[model samples]
Target: MENNQEGILLTSAEQSYLWTTYQADTMAVCVFNHFLQHIKDNEIKSLIVFALQLSEEHANFIREIFIKEKIQIPQGFTESDVNLHAERLFSDVFYLNYIKNMAKGGLVTYGRVLQNVYRKDILSFFSACLSQSIELNSRAIDISLKKGLAIRPPTIPYLEKLEFVHKQSFILEGLGRREALTGTEVTNLFANIQTNYIGTSLATAFSQVCKTKKAQNFFKRGKEIALKHIEVFSSYLKMSSLPVPGTYEQMVTQSKDAPYSDKLMMFHFSLMIYSGVGNYGLSTAETQRSDLVADYTRLNAEILKYSEDGANIMIAEKWLEQPPLAANRRDLAKG
Candidate 1:
């Protein structure tokens, strides 16, 4: 063993975290390689090929770190274990959708990891990963649009800045009383918390599986966003003296069973994103009456971006739920 004490600098917690992340990245590369062979779309296939190379490289680097640290690395899922040829039996549309969904999960994970790490080397590693993730996601988004696979969310016109008169009479009257939360408000809060948990868990898993330093760093940043959301929700629960929900854990893959198909995974995540946006909107509306309106509004805006990205992936996969459009409105008017 190379002098174990000379260059190994990560703390035990950091080492363990890196090891777990590396294992996940190993699995991700295997899956992407499988995707590369199975996908027929030349553009998507090219993108996956590039992504796979990046993932494999990162995996090797993490393995090197483990070797230097005298740590035993876990053997995560790999292409050898999965039936890529068998998966190819499925439609090309399904395959593309699957990769896109997995990418969204990865985006979330990189975001979180970036938030938790403080070391210069670790931070640099995550930053690079984040950049790659953005590039990959951008490519996916473009493909989805060109292929007519993207879904668009409802958008309202942006209003120019306008000043409103301040009113303090109501604030003065209710200054001493603690406001009660309505049932609808409580329900929305619970839903938003659940959505954040799911999003974060998926993101963390993606980061763990993606192999490039750029991608891993991106995953770290995603992890941070999820953690922050968790804190925000937990604080609210605490103020109400409610118990915090358990941390969301990734579903374990069975030794015998194939992991979730990519299409299904993307569809499931897209739903979560949509639900999160709706819940946030409701929460923001309710908070309008509270002193925390500014805080909730900021959070809502951040989550909205996440939700929009999720919707875009769904569109790329052609898995979005049905919604009324202008044509439908015109038909209804004619009727």
Candidate 2:
């Protein structure tokens, strides 16, 4: 047997976490492959293909590790599990948002894995995955901006000069307190900016895919909520002198005959909500200042509600994962 010291031995909790991540990665690969078949944009397709390959590789790696440790691998979703036809029924806009949201979730997952891992090899692997995820997200963001699938936020000019002068009782400030945003505040603003973009993209995609008056109305309301948040975040970015993210200029669609299915659209939206929650959690933890904390906390709560709504939609659509629930306390006690 390989030495436990040489190969990392995960605790039960760690195993559970790894299992969750593995399942998410597997789902991502399946979603990307479906997107690959329908996507016509070469750059976006290439990025999605690359991301799929990475996710597959990571899944294999985890499986190998679990095998080596004599631990049962979690029964996660596989290529055989996903309904490709159902996914393909969605519009290309929905696919783009799906992939982007998955990539965002990957960023958070890898970051958490990096923090939890202690073994050198495991840490290095997670770190590499984290970097790759970030790159993928950046590329997706770029594609979304170019295709006008995302909305851009405002930005402030970079400081080119700084001067400090002090008198007996007076001081000169280059920018007013209201005009400059602190670094910590800027980070929170950026987090919210990304969240808004994801939310809007999902709403727009859902509206197009569902093609029903009620569904479209639901999506329109979602878009309005995201727009309000975008404005709030943009104000912060403008005050801080930071660049805003790109905005959507045109709607994305696949062939009229192959409009996205409602199930696929809702699944993608659910994924985005989970990603947004993860990002908000990270931002809340990362920001230490009181004002920034308050902002992130409020944002986090709003996202929680959005996530709940998405979950309800998924349940109505029967697209959510059905994990086994414990029967009763007596059953558990007997075990």
Candidate 3:
């Protein structure tokens, strides 16, 4: 709320966005670098290069802003988190899909950040990020479709007449056979299935490449959890006679070579877990079926526990970076 000769001071929301973006882009640099190691297809390689460039630029921009504000820069993931000399752990197709998924995530994240930004400079930066993510998402989708890897959702018949729900049975699932899924419900189910599929494959790859026994075991458990959630989501579509999206788990290689440090892998996996919780919560709110809601609630609870366990592990190893926090007035007074 205060400004100096330097510039307008950062609000808590603005500060949070900058800090989170800095950390995410730092991890993106390491991730794309590792992806570049095994990429054989020129098309996929170019996409990865573009993504890496954006991440680097964003990281630099945030670094300069932090310097101007005199805030200590976060020690985010860096080249030390990755090994370019490592063997290929993922196929080229997987690289393409990973970028596609990441672009989708970026779109959601940048939109949220844009809403929180109050300063003109910060708004402009996030606006640029949002535009870039839109273009990146389109490119990724085009490439995936061309490569025959895109798993589109099922199309429904056009509604001839608009009608409102009359009976309570419209939202019921306990007694009789449930009615057909609404378009919104179908979309969420398909989206969550896709998310879990990617999570499972990424976790599987990390489990193999992670350094310490603890990290490896953690990834293995994450993979199992993701697989279980995928099954649950897929079954809902199956019950509706809808086609389920396929996974890219087979794209992961048997290489045990470490492409990234254990700390980086753990942090990346934790981010995906937290994102899944958000997605599932949205899905639950959009659905009307009691059974679907119950399933999402149960899966969300499971992932919350898993995410907490991961945080504890990161804390034990002192790998978790502390976010910006308010000063403890009581502690200062005591001192």
Candidate 4:
């Protein structure tokens, strides 16, 4: 790493990632504020506050970078997007799990950004972000474990001996001849199931409080897709005689009160949908079984369509922020 990285202009990767991080952190601040208002458990409250602090700090840090470069800072989520007095829509355990999943997303995002960015300040920022997400993720797990609410991944029996695959069918699908699920395959399958579980719970809650019929219908569709994805992922685990993880639907409450604005909720759901798509893509790559690849490919397409519909909703609502783009030489020449 060069010490004079600041002299170099920000790469497209650096600018776009910082831009996205600003939006996500700001949204997180609003969410934590709303969560803080209704949390009765002191331990969970402190964790929420810690998570909020990181988001606030991240936003401020990115704002300084934008200002120094004369880039217009995005008007990300604000206090207007959250209603502090809204009734509780989630239980304490649900709050913890949400934050855990949130940190999981942040880790993946920051890691991806770090790989593409080289500017010194941006590198430092994302490095710190990655570290903070690790801490936040650890704390969430710690709290969950202490409270006996952690969702553990399914376990497979330990390998008793070194083995080699004797058939090309190890990578192929057949009528009745298939190898057992590999550990990596199981890992991806279980992780996808867990992510979709969170999505299903959020969809359930978001659908309950959305004011517009359109948004409500969107969330209901999302919930159905999430539930279906979970079922499909769980089938693989069940085939290996592993116990499939259950849903977090019971973590949600029946409250009809809206804690966050429709726009904020919509953006939040979009973030989850995008992350879920990435998870599926990664699972497709790491998984060895042809059946798993086929399933992931099909489900990935389903969510991509859902994501496009969600983006259209946000654009219509004027809630989607435009990212930095390339200059149009044709338009410039015409002008």
lDDT of 4 by residue, 274-326 (tens): 99889999989998788889999999999999999999988988989999898
TM-score, every prediction: 0.49, 0.66, 0.96, 0.96
List the global CA lDDT of all models: 0.58, 0.64, 0.88, 0.88
Global local distance difference test of model 3 = 0.88
Candidate 1 vs candidate 2, lDDT winner: 2
lDDT of 3 by residue, 1-335 (tens): 11223557899998888998998899999999988877899988999999999999899888888888898999999788999999998999888888888888888889888887788778888888999999888988888898887878899899999998777777886655466888999999999888888888988998887877887788889888988988998888888899998888999999999888888889998889878998999999999999899999999999999999999999999999999998899999997
lDDT of 1 by residue, 136-200 (tens): 77887788789986543223235579956365523332554345444445445554555566566
Task: Rank all candidate structures by their TM-score, best first, as comma-separated numbers.
Answer: 4, 3, 2, 1
Instruction: Judging by TM-score, tell me the better candidate of 2 and 3.
Output: 3
Per residue, candidate 2 scores C-alpha lDDT tens digits across 1-335 of 22234445665445655566676677667667767777777877778788888889878877876787786776666656444564344455655665675676777677666666766555666777788888888888888888877644444457689965343222123232234554655656776676677678657655755744545676777788778778876876666556787554244444223234455455555666666666667666765444555666787688678667766766775656554243479878997
Collision pairs in model 3 = none
Candidate 2 local accuracy as lDDT?
0.64
Task: Show the lowest summed lDDT stretch of 10 residues, model 3.
Answer: 1-10
RMSD of 3: 2.3
Each candidate's number of clashing pairs is: 34, 15, 0, 0
lDDT: which is higher, 1 or 3?
3
